[model samples]
Target: DLSKNNKQMDKIQKSLEAFLENKRKEFPRFFFLSNDELLQILAAAQDIRKVEKHCSKIFCNIMKLKLGEDSNSNQIYAIISAEGESVAYQPPVKARSEEKIEATLTEIEQKMVETIAKKLSKFYSEYDFTNIDKSSWVFNDIGQVVSAFSQIIWTELC
Candidate 1:
């Protein structure tokens, strides 16, 4: 029974790790938040009295920043409050013209792509790509590098 229990524990641990790895892949910016920060966010999320939809939206937006997603004031507030900061809530401004918003998004996207390319080029130089395979560690590292480069660009753009 003890051996069976140990095997079950190992399976559970492996599954948890795999889930975390998938999350990291999907949102590379997640690594930017320290464990403490994550815990704070989780705690704040639980305390949120808003409706489930709104609460999930807020959490999603905060986490989406890791994926280079743009955030509005509300999302910013959610993030701030999650950190246990006492900040006043100020509503977001009126929406800008669609054309202007589109133009700005296009510019940001272009900049992000260029930045990623440059970073990837530098990263490639440091690796022996000839031996690269899907299972290689370098392949995984490239994904992380791209995510980090994107986060940098997004933060700078914001």
Candidate 2:
């Protein structure tokens, strides 16, 4: 039963795809740009976060054109309008809280330290720095290692 249901859904999806393909051919101008192109355009012109809003507006406009000004279409548009209005009405808050900012910084520092440790661990067994003060030498060694690693794999590191 599950397999049959899945096959039926797949058939329906294929049929929908065909219908959309036909519509796309019929209205080439409206579907000229692919989704990636639209995303790139929005990303270049506006903040990345605003891309979603732009996409939603585009979708709603297309839906309105397809559905025309029927009662059901008006209802759907009204719902979309309300949601857009609500988003616009909301007050902007700080992007990150103090705790979250600190946590992110801590995470970044931990990763940097881990990377340095992993890179330098092989040297530990070969050389003896046991007599040296860890605070001074370890930091300096890490900096050198990181700088060297960054130079060698700068593209990958980024």
Candidate 3:
């Protein structure tokens, strides 16, 4: 009594269930691409801003899974507690100050850094650091990304 569309839907449903079952068998815990793996993927991206495209096309295929739905970026300073002897913008505070005044990446920011790292590693076999460029959003917002994501990963894991 099924129409062609119904039969097709039934096939899709069965296929998805089978795929999910296979995934469970493959990865005992949830599978996450490692930091290195992520870096490779990002490094290989033709346009870093178009990272979503590269990720969706390449990594999704390799991982056989979906990526996080959102991508966000921000800016933060890398505070230096003690300016080097010859560095500019010297802080008023002396060296070894107990103020704990060094830069700390926010929870969400850290997660983004880790995510980027994991994605970029997929493209670069070695130490690829295209995200370090100031012209790129990833580099400009690296600190914020690191801070944000750190908290996220911690909450999920711990």
Which lDDT tens digits does candidate 1 get at residues 1-158? Answer: 99999999999978866755564454444354544443343344322222112322323222221111343321222122233332211331222333332232233334444544665677656655445343544334435454664464456457
Which model, 2 or 3, shows the larger TM-score?
2
Q: Which candidate's lDDT is highest?
A: 1
- Per-candidate Cα RMSD to the true structure, in Å, reads 17.6, 20.6, 20.4
Over 4 Å off, model 1: 33-158
Please give the ranking of all candidate structures by lDDT, highest first, separated by commas. 1, 2, 3
Provide the lDDT at 40 for model 3: 45
Better of 1 and 2 by TM-score: 1
lDDT of 3 by residue, 1-158 (tens): 56988999999978866654554344322124443433443353332223333223222222111222233222122221121111111111121222211111122224434555764444334323433332443343334334554454456456
lDDT of 2 by residue, 63-86 (tens): 111112443221111112322221
> What is residue 158's positional error in candidate 1, in angstroms?
28
- For each of the candidates, give the backbone clash count: 0, 0, 43
lDDT of 1: 0.40
lDDT values of the candidates?
0.40, 0.38, 0.34
Q: Which regions of candidate 2 are displaced past 4 Å?
A: 32-158
